[model samples]
Every structure is written in C-alpha cells, then in structure tokens.
Target: MEFTETLLPGVGVRYDGQSRDGQPIAIVVAHDGDVEIVTYQRTDPDAVQYRLELAAHAALAVAELLGSPRVSARLVDLTREIPGLHTRRLVVAPGSRYAGRLLGDSKARTRTGCSIVAVVRGPDVIAAPAPDFTLLAGDTLIAIGSERGLEALAELLGLTPDDPVPVMTAPV
Candidate 1:
C-alpha cells in the first residue's frame, strides 16, 4: 500500500493511506506521544466514520498485536520459493538447555541441517546472527530448514517431539 506523510507543523505528523479494500485510513501522532487513528466512511472518503485516540503505550500495544501476524506471514512467504524449505520462529523458553549458550556450541546446523537466520531479542532483530551469538531466555530464533530438520532443531533446543512450536501464529 502507498502512504502519504504530512508534517502538522507544531502539532505532529499525519500519515494517510488507503486500505486494500480502498477505504481511507489515517494516523496522526501528536508531539506529546498521543496518537489518533482515523477511518473514513466507505461511501465518502473525506467523511470520518470513526476515530480512536490512544496514548503512546496503548498505541504500542496495539501495534504489537497487529504487527506480529504480518511478520509471520512474510516469513512464510519468503520460504515458499524454495521447495522443501520451512521457516519457524522458536522461542528460548526459560529452563531450556540452550539458554546462555553460544550459537556455535549448539551445532544446530551441523546436526539438524537447520540454519539460524536471525535472532529476535525484544525490540532488536539481529539479522544473519553470527555463530558467536549468545542464546538467552525469551530470545526468538528464526530458523530455516526442511520439515524434519526443523523438528530435529527443536529437539536440540530441549523441546520434546510433541511440544508445540512457540512462535507467531501460522498464516491462514
């Protein structure tokens, strides 16, 4: 989708875009960390149908809820080009054996044939993380491999074969 951003002078910034369904939507962020979400009427783009005002913290929470599914969908799309390849985001749960260990020490690639493409630690995304990268509790490991390889990698990460993969929800 295309978006237009405008400076609101002393007020803040306004971002306007059209949704996939052709409905107009806007977000206005004030200088004081307040946010306004505006949705225009379907019949008249210029007419406001709904508006939501939120503080910075509430906006962040909403963003997280909406953004994670999109990210997960994109990851699945990326792996579609390669046959027999799958991508999964595995979390490093507390009490797991891999926590506080170096990526090289895990030998996940050598043993399971899965590759750790990135590591997500809170708000930071370490792309193409090196072998020296340290695994920690609450870290999200982005792994790409075959189905069997991914299962093996989960086993190596101290998960049981029956354990459900902890990651973003799968795309519908």
Candidate 2:
C-alpha cells in the first residue's frame, strides 16, 4: 500500500516507536554510523498528522498542527528529567571513519540509552534512523545518551575529539 500524503515540514522519516500516549509513533532514535529510514503504511488515511514523542501533553497539542513530529520535544528534556544523562554529537567529515555506513540502529544504540535524534546530511535533514541505516561521509549526527556510552560510539565510528563538522564548512 502507498500513501500520497505530502511531506510535512517536519515529517521526514520515522526513527522510533510510539508517541507519548502509547499511540504508535516510529522515531529515529539514533544516527551514529548509519542511515535509518522507516516507512509504515498509515493504517488510517485520516490519521492525525500530529504525532509527538513528547513526554508531556502540552507539546502534543502543537504537534497536531504541524502534522509532523518536532525534534525539540524528543530532546532537550533529557537534561531536565534524565539527571546525569549525556547527549552525544557525532560530526562525520571526509576523513572520519564513519564516512560510509549506516549508523543509527535503535536496538544497537539504545543498548547504551543513546538515541540519534537528527542527521544533517548535506542540505537535507533526517529525523531518525531505524536499524540497517548506513552513514556516509560528511554527515552530522546528533545523538543523545550517556556520556560514556556516547564516547564508545565515537571511537567505533572513528570520530576524533577535534574534527570539524562537515555541515559548518560546506559553502552556503
């Protein structure tokens, strides 16, 4: 089955599972060294376009208007509620080791409580990554997880401590 719905501004690819209400919401929990894009047949065409992983009801109200999930709702809160949680950011450039493979697999990354919230690849922005996603050179990954766990991911991906982000250097 195919859905012809327009690509909402924030609705890109789902990376996780279930919205806060226990409603079915797929999200891209991580984008470490791979690219994960999930596609599911919207069981209901009239299905509410607004879906949020927000832990609160207030943000869900705004999500309804956008017809797509807002990333801020998933992140940011980590600092407040997660006490001692760490968000790991991986910026892959030409020389970085993760230049060509799928990085974000929920089962794999989540093992360490790290989820990939965003992947900035060139001009496009991917919301989340499902398993089997691969990462290419010059991709910027914004991941959230424990500090130690994230550090391990950095090593596995071959990202050094002082590499510049590919997105910032790309000519505008």
Candidate 3:
C-alpha cells in the first residue's frame, strides 16, 4: 500500500511500488496527461513484465469504475449524519497475513468493532460482502466505524499510522 513518488521535473510524477505478489510496479503520469502502468519481473526489476497505457480520458474512466467518488460521497454523507462515525479505505497489501484468507477469519467486526461495508477489487465492488468472501491482495476494504476502531482495523491489517498508505476518511 505504500509507494514512493518522485517528481520528474519537466515530465510528471513517477510512483514506484511492489505489487501484491511481490513484483515491482511503476506508474508514470506524463505531463501530457497520459498514464502508464508497468509491472517488472521479480528477478529483474528493470525487466518489463507488462505495460498498460491509458489516455487521460481512459484513466478517468478507470477511476470512475473504481467508484472512488461515489463511495466517498456516500461515506461522507453517512459520517455527517452520525457523530463519532468515520470511514476508511484499507488495502490488502503483499505479505499481509490476511491476504488469501476468508473475511470471517479476520474476525474484524468482532475484534475491532468495525464493519467492512464493501470490498473493491479492480473494477468490481462487492457491497455487503459475506463473511465467507475471500480477501485477495490488492483488494480495498471500505470500512465504517469509530476512529479508534478504524485505527485498530488498520493495525490488524499490518499497517501503522506512520505508514504512507492513505487512510481516507470522512470529515467528522
């Protein structure tokens, strides 16, 4: 979930990170508005495994498909209506203990008192996912709970507050 971003001077920005499967990946945003998603081999970091090129419009479409805006709006509205309620996005990263495990195995709700309302994987959103649902690497969990509970859930997912991973939450 943590990535390093480097400014490319006259170009744009380059984000480097490791994939959920331990493969190196780089995302480059060009000044011309194009985006490239590249994956490298585990053995050779510089060797290209595959590359996906997206135009500005295509990138926006992909973002919409991921439902960031819609989900954020709904979470914001819910938080605004309730006191001490918050929402956060928790990513299942590589090496996570829960990766490839069942949602019920984590006992997230029983342990942290946080409800995982949705699971966003690639272009698919599994709303109200069952406890039997399997969690895969790269899956983004949309959880709603108190701040303390959410922080606990993050720790359960092997993330600390100091991690660079973005914990997007609605304004209290």
Which is the leading candidate under TM-score? 3
Please identify model 2 stretches exceeding 4 Å from their true place. Answer: 1-74, 104-113, 159-172
Per-residue lDDT of 1-172 in model 2, one digit per residue for the tens?
Answer: 1122232344343334544454544443222212232334468733445533443344455455645444543565555477766665577766654566556422336444466777766556687765566777767677776677676656555654365432211111
Off by over 4 Å in 3: 1-69, 159-172
- RMSD of each candidate relative to the true structure: 12.8, 15.2, 10.0
Q: Evaluate residue 118 in candidate 2 and report its C-alpha lDDT on the 0 to 100 scale.
A: 79
- When 1 and 3 are scored with TM-score, the better candidate is 3
lDDT of each: 0.76, 0.52, 0.80
* Candidate 2, poorest ten consecutive residues by summed lDDT: 28-37
TM-score of each predicted structure versus truth: 0.52, 0.43, 0.55
Model 2 clash number: 27
Q: How close is candidate 1 to the true structure, as a TM-score?
A: 0.52
Error of 3 at 171 (Å): 20
Clashes of 3: 0
* Candidates sorted on lDDT, descending: 3, 1, 2
Worst 10 residues of 3 by lDDT: 163-172
